[model samples]
Target: MMRFHISYLACAAAIIGAALTAAPTAAAHQTTHQTRHQTTRLVFPGQSIQRAVDAAQPGDTVLVTPGTYRESVTVSTPGLTLRGTGRETVIEPGTTKAADSCAEHGNGICVLGTKDRDVEGVTVASLTVRNFTGTGVFAMATDGLTVRNVTAVNNGVWGIAQERSVRGLFVKNTARDNGDAGLFLANTIKEEAGAADTQGTVVEHNRLEGNRIGITVRRLRNLTVAENHLTGNCAGVFVVGDENKPRAGALTVRDNTVADNNKSCPATARLEALQGSGIVLTGTEDTLVTGNHVTGNAGTSSLSGGIVLFKSFVGTPGERNRITDNTLEGNAPADLVDTDTGHDNTFTGNACTASRPAGLC
Candidate 1:
């Protein structure tokens, strides 16, 4: 009787194993069907990148070869990838004016989606976009947009700019010598709006230098700026806010190297003269600044410091912000500063020598 019971148990185990194996087999068949439909279109030098992009369907990739192409690109399709061979695949301005709406707007590449719907699952990678009057790469109303391994240099405005986008990943890219921030994300650039929820957008593992600011997070929420190298800009990172509702905050700035942001920028119409700011946060709430290495940023500007909490221009003060666990040195005026009248702001566990109000280190 014991042998019969053991044999029955073995049979039950074999039945369960077979069922599990069969379920995966069916799933594999479905996955194969889905993967079979994705296509790749190649574009060479002297070819129209926009034409190839327009001809592509959803789940298509437009791969460009290593050459200099003088045209602008606009991508509106979901589940699309626009990848280049490497930095050798350069995009410059076209010969004539009004090449397209993107070129007409003075942008290198534009990923445009409507106000009502988001363009989802787009990827732009491995290219060099330079010398545009406007932004190198621009996006709006996008979901899950990934811009990786791209180089943006010497643009008149921002190197990489996005608005009304969520779930974005900007990684392993280089942005330098732009007029504005190397990477700029905002709720809206022209209009006044409340903060927009980014739904876990991440800017990580990039290098930003020689711009007005390294990275700017303006009026955004639920995002992270991490693990980037920022130098030679007027400011390393700027988390900007104003008197708008649903205020801009709830983001993380962590594990970055912010150094030597001492370039002088004249005052713009909306901003003060900028220099030597490592990480500046104004009019934010519930923000976390941690684990950063800030050094060699020295200037006498109003926003100058290793880490600062200055008064916002629009009368909204930072509240519930936490500055912790950072290493700061060689910053002028102070290594830490808090000049705003904010509530629930805390500074602890930082390795710094000087602070404006004292004891912040």
Candidate 2:
């Protein structure tokens, strides 16, 4: 592949400049008539946010006032809005952990839906959840689930996570200092299966730092990650897949600033040691990677690069993906590294300084 020295940064701006949909707040879910008698449940300091949430009806709003509350919250009802007074509302582990399934599972907040029924249209917004042994906010089997403006820090596995869900929107959130990926979206975490279509789930405008990976989109399809800031993680964004029947791909990573993700994380049971990786695609196909700014990420690990098309841990090769119109610089090893050959991957119209095998700048 012959490398071209073209700056499509200006052209990329014109193409990706269309404004996205205005994010809607949880309180705006109901119409005027439906909200005429909207119930408002309040939780004060020293009170339980969970108590208020449990007492609320489907359309009710559980609003927690500013204070530190040490308890895990579980929301099972549909169409409920759980809001806090911004960052002033803090939730951490309680002294004697709640015996509820959520707390027992080590999660800060749980939105539960059974396999037979999905909790629909529930929203969690504007709070801080930290110091949990498990996820900051976790959801399963939901539709139209929105988690916005939540600050998730220092969690064990994931900051904000979801599985077996659809049409979920995660925007304007901050996830930092997590043990694993700051934001994790997957078909299911418990088993190996074909990829699930997310029906256009969106992750946008979030800041991710100090995590194993900023965001991990695993075994899912039809999702979009855009306009996010990622730094201080071992890897910026990982689009991961394996030998599952329907390969994970058909997603978009666009218009994001990913820089200096040079934190060194030892290899996990399933993955290699990682550092300074910008956007990585493994065992996936037909993905569109465009209009991203990846800079100053440098490391010696095999996975390290500005943009990497790697064979999966299970040795599934990526195929037919487009790596285009990105801006990259100062990435050691290479600005673009394609580890698999004859896979029909294309690298075109990017402004970068170096590449591993010579022509993919």
Candidate 3:
């Protein structure tokens, strides 16, 4: 009798523990369903965008209908998706010269301006954010952020600026005619004297045009920039190392169509003589510039080239880079210029022609 009683007690204790573990999981599943499915559609017919973002919760969808929203929007919640109805959904400042004059200095849309990891997994899609005094869409110190099918034009600075440890998808966005670079990515190093590492970013299938620099990557690693059309910018792409950090590594620039950039006018009364190039790689290492069509770069006084590898500082020269399979043509003098003080950078299979090469059609 005593043995049977002890066995029964052991079985009862095991059952109770199992029940305790399963209870919390059931509650969590119910919470997830409540958060994700609870969506709110926001129509902005002369209303403010700030109001709609304030009313959103985690895992909620804010569907913005087709209209003009003349206020800045910031997303501080995690798992929130703000999607526009169509391309006509515009987000700009209320004033006319608000962007250029810096009268209203705010981002059109933002995810986590403050340094908090709580605001992750935010997505902004299918909107036209233009003419903002600051960045068009700024993602700072956030992870798993996605910006898709958005058009950002004529901003004072970068169209999309990702800073300080942001890992995300930026796809099918068009950034054009901005004053600075179209897209700027710098890992969230503080302005103080320290180094912060930004890594594992994918920038693909976008159009960057008419900006001072098409795309600029600073102090980054494990980055892939591919299949984008960079045209009519001062320089098609500029990759530089932060002098403070000096450890920018392993960028892949592949299969991009970089053409008609480096347009130079004569030195005006107010301005000095200007020049640009197709690709400017400065103080970077282990970069692959391959299979790109770079053409039509012109300079006013000097000659522009297809690729300019410039050595910025007096360290180990930018080495171990590969430039291969690119069709380089229509620049002034040569196709490639290596002004680097360092050595051992290889250039192979680059076809240069005075006219358009074959298979560019």
Candidate 3 regions with alpha-carbon error over 4 angstroms: 1-36, 95-104, 116-118, 188-197, 264-274, 300-303, 313-316, 353-361
Single out the weakest 10-residue window by summed lDDT for candidate 2: 1-10
Q: Which candidate's lDDT is highest?
A: 1
Task: Between candidates 1 and 2, name the one with more favorable lDDT.
Answer: 1
Per-residue lDDT of candidate 1, residues 1-361 (tens digit): 4453334334333422321111112111111012357755556565688888897888887777678999899999999999887798899999888647889889999999998999999999999999999999999999999999999999999999999999999999999999999999999988999999999999999999999999999999999999999999999999988778899999999999999999999999978999999999999999999999999898899899999997678878999999999999999889998998989999999999999998899
Model 2: per-residue Cα lDDT over 1-361, one tens digit each: 0111012222222223422123223331321112347665555566678777877888887776667889999999999999886888899988895789989988999998999999999999999999999999999999999999999999998999999999999999999999999999999978999899999999999999999999999999999999999999999999998889899999999999999999999998988899999999999988999999999898999989999989888888888999999999988788999896537899999999899779887
State which candidate, 1 or 3, has the greater TM-score: 1
lDDT of 2 at 254: 95
- Clash count, candidate 2: 0
- Residue-level lDDT of model 3, residues 190-288, one tens digit each, is 562222344567888999988877888876777888899998887788777534554565879888888888655345452234355677677777889
How does each model score on lDDT? 0.88, 0.87, 0.69
Q: Candidate 3: give the clashing pairs.
A: 164-188
Count of backbone clashes, every candidate in sequence: 0, 0, 1
Worst lDDT 10-window in candidate 3: 24-33
RMSD of each: 12.3, 12.3, 13.6
Error of 1 at 162 (Å): 0.5
